[model samples]
Target: MSIWGKFAGAVVGAYFGGPLGAVAGTVAGHYAFDRELDKEVAFTIALIALSAKMAKADGIVSPVEVDAFYRICRVPEGEQRNVARVYKLAQEDIAGFEAYARQVAEIFADRPKVCEDVLDALFYIAYADGTLNHAEEVFLRRVAENFALSEADFSRIHARHNPNVFDPFAVLGIDPNASFDAARSAWLKASRENHPDQLQARGVPVEILHLANDRMAIINSAWEMIRKEQFNKDV
Candidate 1:
């Protein structure tokens, strides 16, 4: 079963049993899930390390970010012990950092929506100590773009701490549409124009590609939200 499935199973088992059973079930389920996929364990560790790297970008890593990461992992004491082992393994694999990001991109690629969750959590960590520096913003923006967030989405999230503003609709060169089809057409056109892959093919740098990816993610998310809003109104 997938890691996500195992987590779901544990949550389900916990509810059916006493609190103690739930705790035990959650641990056992995670252990089984980890054992079934060696690569998954490694990838999880790598992701944590990546998070760590991002956290330290500003030359300081806050206690809150550390705690948030542990909270996200959701492991019991025994499982956490194992996770510590994996964490150490990840720290030693610095050469694999880029590869780790690539792996993560693949794992979560099909679910671009989840990238927002990840980014939100990361920002929670970044701002936990009540401040964010330029280095922190640089790394966070890079990761956000890698997930293909669009300009609107990026600006929305970016504005959280950065404060300086930009017009999202204008960034995509679109105006309020009288029809859904027009809105979608404009959004799709912007997406194709800003696609990271397309820019990369034209010899854009990795940093630029990352920027494009971030913009695309935001555009796609905004379009989806608009579509859903229109559909709900019609319903």
Candidate 2:
């Protein structure tokens, strides 16, 4: 079953206790099940919580941002209220985003790429309003730090979403002076890593696979652009 179906079911369980669990419990209400939360379930909850906190980074949650989230998360019609409840509760909760980010970092400690995916999702929401504001950038940078992502990692992800900048090399996390073979190798490695199947294996909810799909498109585009440029330069 999809993550939404899991949430819609009468019994909901979140193994980890803390801000994320609190928000999930509140959303699930009295329908408590005694079992460890599935990784995918936990992942969805984390995404909602983090997205909510990011929305408040700029002090307001624009409808466009919310719409972008819905599109990325693909919350079903029947489960929108429940999903929205989690988002709202997380936003209203007094816990700072760092706490939630820390929890997510710990939850996916072994899977750094999944953490990168989370940051990528946040960038998608941040840019939905047509710009990435100062507050939002600060919030994202701090979250990236909390996630244990390096500066280079953050820059590569940011390049994909930053409208005003389009450095294909940055998107592929490659040095401009790198050999064509090295660039092609980087493209292949990235494509393998960001594939939807790999993401699903890493506990990303299937609903969120579209994010992976979109990211793959960007990665591929960057490679194609680089390939064409190199060919023209050689000619």
Which segments of candidate 1 are over 4 A away from where they belong? 1-47, 96-98, 158-235
What's the lDDT for all of these models? 0.51, 0.86
Q: Which candidate number has the best lDDT?
A: 2
Candidate 1, residues 46-126, lDDT tens digits: the string is 345566666566666567777766765555564555445434444443443344445445555654544544565466567
* Tens digits of per-residue lDDT for model 2, 1-235: 8788876552254435767877888765653543466778778888899999998887888889889999998887988888888899999999999999998898888787889989999999999978999999999999999999999999999999988888999999999988988999999999999999999999898888988888899999889888889644331
Query: Model 2: C-alpha RMSD to truth?
Result: 2.2
Least lDDT summed over 10 consecutive residues: which range in candidate 1? Answer: 15-24
In candidate 2, position 116 carries an lDDT of 93
**Candidate 1, lDDT over the whole model:** 0.51
- List pairs with backbone clashes in candidate 1: 145-214, 148-213, 148-217, 149-214, 149-217, 149-218, 150-215, 150-217, 150-218, 150-219
